[model samples]
Target chain A: MTQHTQPSAKALVPFVSVDNMMRLIHHVGLEQMLRDLAGYVEDDFKRWELFDKTPRVASHSDVGVIELMPTSDGESYGFKYVNGHPKNTSEGLQTVTAFGLLADVYTGYPVLLTEMTILTALRTAATSAMVAKYLAPKGATTMAMIGNGAQSEFQSLAMKAICGITSVRLYDKDPAATAKCAANLAGTGLNVVICTSPEQAIEGAQILTTCTADKQSATILSDNMVGAGVHINAIGGDCPGKTELAAGILSRSDVFVEFPPQTRVEGEIQQMPEDFPVTELWQVITGAKTGRSSAEQITLFDSVGFAIEDFSALRYVRDHIKGSDFFFELDMLADPDDPRDLFGMVQRAAR
Target chain B: MTQHTQPSAKALVPFVSVDNMMRLIHHVGLEQMLRDLAGYVEDDFKRWELFDKTPRVASHSDVGVIELMPTSDGESYGFKYVNGHPKNTSEGLQTVTAFGLLADVYTGYPVLLTEMTILTALRTAATSAMVAKYLAPKGATTMAMIGNGAQSEFQSLAMKAICGITSVRLYDKDPAATAKCAANLAGTGLNVVICTSPEQAIEGAQILTTCTADKQSATILSDNMVGAGVHINAIGGDCPGKTELAAGILSRSDVFVEFPPQTRVEGEIQQMPEDFPVTELWQVITGAKTGRSSAEQITLFDSVGFAIEDFSALRYVRDHIKGSDFFFELDMLADPDDPRDLFGMVQRAAR
Candidate 1:
């Protein structure tokens, strides 16, 4: 029975879904996994030259945007099909959902198909915390999270686990969202406070995180609300017309982005001129550029997402589930005895 | 019993490999599917305005090329991952292999994942024959095929069935490839003749197709070889550095393409001037532009493969596999009752 369902020549692809990834998080412990994932993301950025990168291909519609993010490291290739539709929550669906493939470059056969809905959140938060570790001051302990929506708790947990953040402040347009975030953060050895406004949320925080999801340009943080020596993790301003921080915030800080060309179009830097002088995060990780200038300087990580993060996360899932029950085999590649006989496989199937 | 596999909201992504796609073709019969898929592709082209049509995104490497072809009609979206590696045959692989997905636009959930390697061959041929129905001379009979590789048989059969072609003149650099084509076309009832050169193949032919898989500027057809009123289906010149015909031929022909912006980059027209006039194929299919204006004026359908053809083929597969054993479900979207409870699913997986 097992012989019939499997291919003869190629390796079987493994299917990893949202539920399985969640189970993986639970099995490995989210705190440990988040820290581990942050390490992987940082390591990938350190050697960015291995990747052949391009700005994501995005198709914008009236309601939302769908994008294809493709990258290859000459040895392996990966791409994700992701969509962002803020109105989906109103229909009891997620604002974002995704799945991706990792393929071997030699044979061009897909080896893994992963559900990225859960992994994207984990990787996004891990990316934010990883950047904070580089740019934030030593012994940074406080983080204020605005937009206490679906991504809020993830932001809090990732910062706490990866960047040693022990205190968090939360605020949102919906008080219930804030309350839920606070409840989720309880018993994590972190002090959580619910604030009323964005100003109050960012008052004395060392790291200010904004993970809001909306279609319009809403300023989650204003210039006056920010202070020196803070690392702003703006995760929501990723679409062509959507942004989180005000233009003044970008001007006052050293803006670091995932990919410069894409950041100029979709990141908060969209509000700035083309020559606004933004540094790519990989350059900082690779020691090609400095991340933080001084103790009194403000830093902004205008991440519109990139392909390297997914590659790291995919490798992480593959490594973690190597001996686990979460693994599944898929017929993803053609296994031919004589590869020239691909047509014969069809003839056999018909017979 | 059903929940033994951990019913947390993880996605299950089903995949059909290249071998399985060929099996689907053999199981469904290529003749019927060619007829059926042509109808679907033509129908989609008729409603061309509804699709969000942008040019394909490509990543070119030293060895070969990888492409992402995406399109959405608001309600549904589709894209294909295809690679064109001309030298892959030396490594016992086909020159082209493809896979694609169909997803709901609102949810970003992939409803189907299919092996598109074999389907691409069928769709490309059917699409060529589809455009030729309207653009070629009514009841065109003889066709000259200049390249005979893996894609040769499909093009011959599709044009024979769809355009009433009664004869095919075959030519290739390797006689073995030509013999392979003649063997595949043995029982198709069309008069198949092996020609020594491109000059002999195009003599007195109504439709001349050039699909040689070369990676450089190759002059497979010159201006003198093509006669008056001949409909040229230029299918092989689809990359930045690849071309099939001499510029002198395009200098005299009325060229049409799937999308002008894309065709100029990847079609035979890439060799022509920036302002070279070309009409979108939809205009001819919708009867908005007069097709084959007088059998005396040379017509060139600069056929760079388009996303809409893959979209149509995917739709046909999705429809035909509804009640068949070929169907498999993929966890492409995170299905959570509460979209914000992705963390909870991870937490429960620990149990």
Candidate 2:
């Protein structure tokens, strides 16, 4: 393991672990990173046509699902391997864990590999706020965050950074989760309110976010709870048969989604019929479609998360970690002196 | 960088780099390792029904194709990221590169990550020899290895270890390739014969292995060149529109394949009609179907490489590297002291 015994340049890949990712976020300031990631997500969304898109390939077991989300922009390729098992938290494991890789399409060589568990949180929140930037009611100042978990603080901070939301009202079924979220957001420049009920949380809020992590379709917000002129960011209902809002709420709102094909299956729109109309968020970002037409029009950003966001997140990390002590080189590829004489490389390495 | 800052057990993943893979292969002896890997491949094939199978998810660009081959037993999941760009060798790069991961199904924790560029060569050869054990002509002693490249030496050694082949006649379109193959196999004990043409290479040989790296449907061996009572191991024609053997040879032979759906699209059988008949190699290994019915009945093992083979290879590496100094720990996962408090873990790391 001497410094002189380093892997060849072709064999090395830059890798960011969770510890480094955390440090990177803190070094850049969490709010600034969220703002920076939102800009990247928006840029990718604006040029979404250049991306090779596919529905996330998922393998579902009885308890959870493992998925591979891959996309490319002709120059570079990225894919994320993520799993979700709500039951994992009960066993003292995270319900969601992920890792991703970015590769050069020209040579098919991996350039960067990083842990995406923390990055997914940042990107998911940034994506929600990005879509909300285009679809939220103008001059929005408050958001009701129903699920107070690992994502609640990030979502609130992202909204504050991107959409100028000054306050977030938090409510979770578990009082301890609300306590944790409230405690985390204490000095994040967001006025936080701890509410006992979902009904109270959404009171006088112009933006309502539902991020309850449940595998089944439990109505966190029934139809009556959703009012007009508010942007509802539904973040937790990302799997089939799992959703946050009631069908009636979706029926009344002008639903905007990242990808219709995916949102119809995994987003809150899954409650609607297959023919139900939803606007693609990219169109709004590209100015191809209208976001919120009138002051009283209800708009819902059905954020199920997509590969492009992860692609942009990986791209951002790949660029941001440069000249920074956030990533190390991993000797992941085999680069023989003579590529064809791989056996000879092995023989020589033995000596 | 402090010695006290060790990653938690849950966050640590075993990583086998390219250098370590080469060392591990030499430590176990290449021929014995090939024989051992063949045993694992055969065992997985026997219980193939227990695996979650899917056609490989592929993204094909104009230059090359990148694929994710994923499969899982109920307890563990494995996937290999592989790329194929036939023109890469011209630029002093390997045409194919790969890495893989094995994760626990229950906790979604990565158990092992390794460079598969070398393991792939070993597993591909072992798989060929394993199929040959079930399908090759009995008392086979000489193998005609056409298209001597990175895979040639491994394939020759595997045939010798698993099927009692004592000699190999090597020929490639390029004489330098044959010379390189012969030089690499000098001390391997298989009497090597350097031939000037494919016709001369096949003389007095019972196994014909074609592993040319052309990305087109070039017939390395035409119908006239392939004879009776020989097992044709076509390894190079693995993508769509790529085939090593002529169509007439496949029509005349009892073609056996790793996975019928995939082989019909990527194997030598891709040249045949959609409904062309072929037997699954697993069925032959499990005795559900017959292999090598008569000495004169030409048998074709159309191997396009399946996820199950990579799954078995990763499994073998995971088991074989135990208590061996071939791997080190990678802090790839973010294991917060409180799983729900991932943000809190990041917050504490700053202090």
Candidate 3:
């Protein structure tokens, strides 16, 4: 066999670290990045029919669940490895952690690998706000954040950037969490209000986002507390039996979801019967279905988080990191001079 | 809100690169590593009922298929991302490439991440040899390796290490591939012979291993080519519509498989009926099923490669990387002082 003189290609995959993710978010201001991510997600949702869709493959344990969400757009493939363990926070660890990769479909080589815990937060918020862009009442300026945990500030900023919201009311079962969220959003140019009760928080709000971190079904928002013409972004009801809104709220609202098959199993719809009617969010984004039919119509965005959002987020990071110091190359693949001579390469490496 | 003085404990994941994988293999001699990996795989198989089992999630395109194989053993979870594009070799790329991760099932923190392109080759060969040790006829020595591509030398070395094979005869449709395998195994202390045809390669050989890399079901070995008292290792027929041996051979031999659900779809047994009797190799390992029934029996180990093997390989690597420079830490998770204050963590990082 002829030997090539070039050094091993040793396929290098660009890796975005947690620190660099923060740097990238800061480089592009937080609100603008949220807006930019919303655009990418909207573009993908508009072309959602072209994507390979599958419910996340999950391994559930007694205490937590780890899932692999994979999707492809014919040209590129992406997947996120994420886990949800609400008890982790009590043990001094994040309740949710994630990382993802984008690979070329043709060559099957990974192009980007990134920490997705921060990005997931951004994309989830952006997705909620993007849906609200179509579903929320016109001139909506205030949002009631019922669970001021990790996602409260991001959801607020995204709504502000995407839907022109100017203020947010934060409330949580734990006052410390509410204080931390209000403190974090102090300088984000949005009016931050610390509400003593969920009902008080939603008193004059046009949007209500529920993002509590718990593994059980809890009535974070009751039906009586919800008013008409308000868009409810339900994010915490992501897994089976872990819903935040009362069933009466979903019964009265024209619910929308990312993917029905997943939402039926994981989202707030899990509380309803299998025949529960929900609009595919893509259809609403594509204008095939009406988002908010009238000023007094109730709209709820039941988000379980789909793979395409992560795919779009990965694509955004892949595109933005070119020639930037926000990423470093990882020598991750064995690219032998002769692709068929992997053994020979290993033998020579002994020298 | 009070801020903690400690640094963010963003979960650090350890990564093993291609270069580091090679170093690790050499640090522990190649043969010993194969033997050690086989032991881990065998140990896992013995307790296979305790594992979380599912068929691989695959996305197939016209050119290739990318798959995510995940499995958990209650304590740790492991998954491999692998792709196979047969035409990739003609374009000077590997026909297969892979990487994998192992994570803690408790906290969902990634424990180890490593490039599995090289490791897959090693683990595949080890798994084949380990199965051969159980089913090969007594006193088996010489083995015939048709389709001498990337996996040929490793299979030969692993057979020598685990199954006590002393010599190998190699043949490929492309003589250049045969020559490359022969040259690579020159100083490996095992006798290697280059043959012009599959017929000549199997002469006087007790084990027949076929690993041709084609996407279609082409017969590399006809039924007449097989004799009694031999163990056949079939590796290339790992996807639907891809098979190496003639159907007559499968009908005549006692078949053993790993994960029947996956093997029946991807292995050579796809040619057989749904009820075709095949022994699960794990059952044989645990003494629940017979391996080699008699000296005159023909046994075929239909090895389609399963998630459990990858899990075991990952477990072995995770155990062996302790106090070794073969890995580096990756800051892959976002850990905040207040777990719910991820937004605050990013805000603080801007300073």
Off by over 4 Å in 3: A1-10, B1-10
Tell me which of candidates 1 and 2 scores higher on lDDT. Answer: 2
Every model: iRMSD: 3.2, 2.1, 4.1
Backbone clashes in model 3, listed as residue pairs? none
Residue B14's lDDT in candidate 3: 90
How do the candidates rank by DockQ, highest first? Answer: 2, 3, 1
Listed in order, each prediction's TM-score against the native is 0.91, 0.98, 0.98
lDDT score, candidate 1, position B29: 81
Positional deviation of residue A230's Cα in model 3 after best superposition, in angstroms? 1.0
Q: Which lDDT tens digits does candidate 3 get at residues A113-158?
A: 9999999999999999999999999999999999988998899999
Q: What are the per-residue Cα lDDT tens digits for candidate 2 across B50-162?
A: 99998898988888999999999989999999999888888888888999999998877789999999899999999999999988888999999999889999999999999
- Mark the regions of model 1 whose C-alpha exceeds 4 Å error after superposition: A1-6, A194-200, A318-326, A333-345, B1-27
Best by DockQ: 2
Model 1 reproduces what portion of true contacts? 0.36
Among incorrect, acceptable, medium and high, the docking class of model 3 is: medium
What lDDT tens digits, residue by residue, belong to model 1 across residues A164-238? 998999999889788877877788888998999988898789999987888779888888888888889999999
Model 2 residue B121 lDDT score = 94
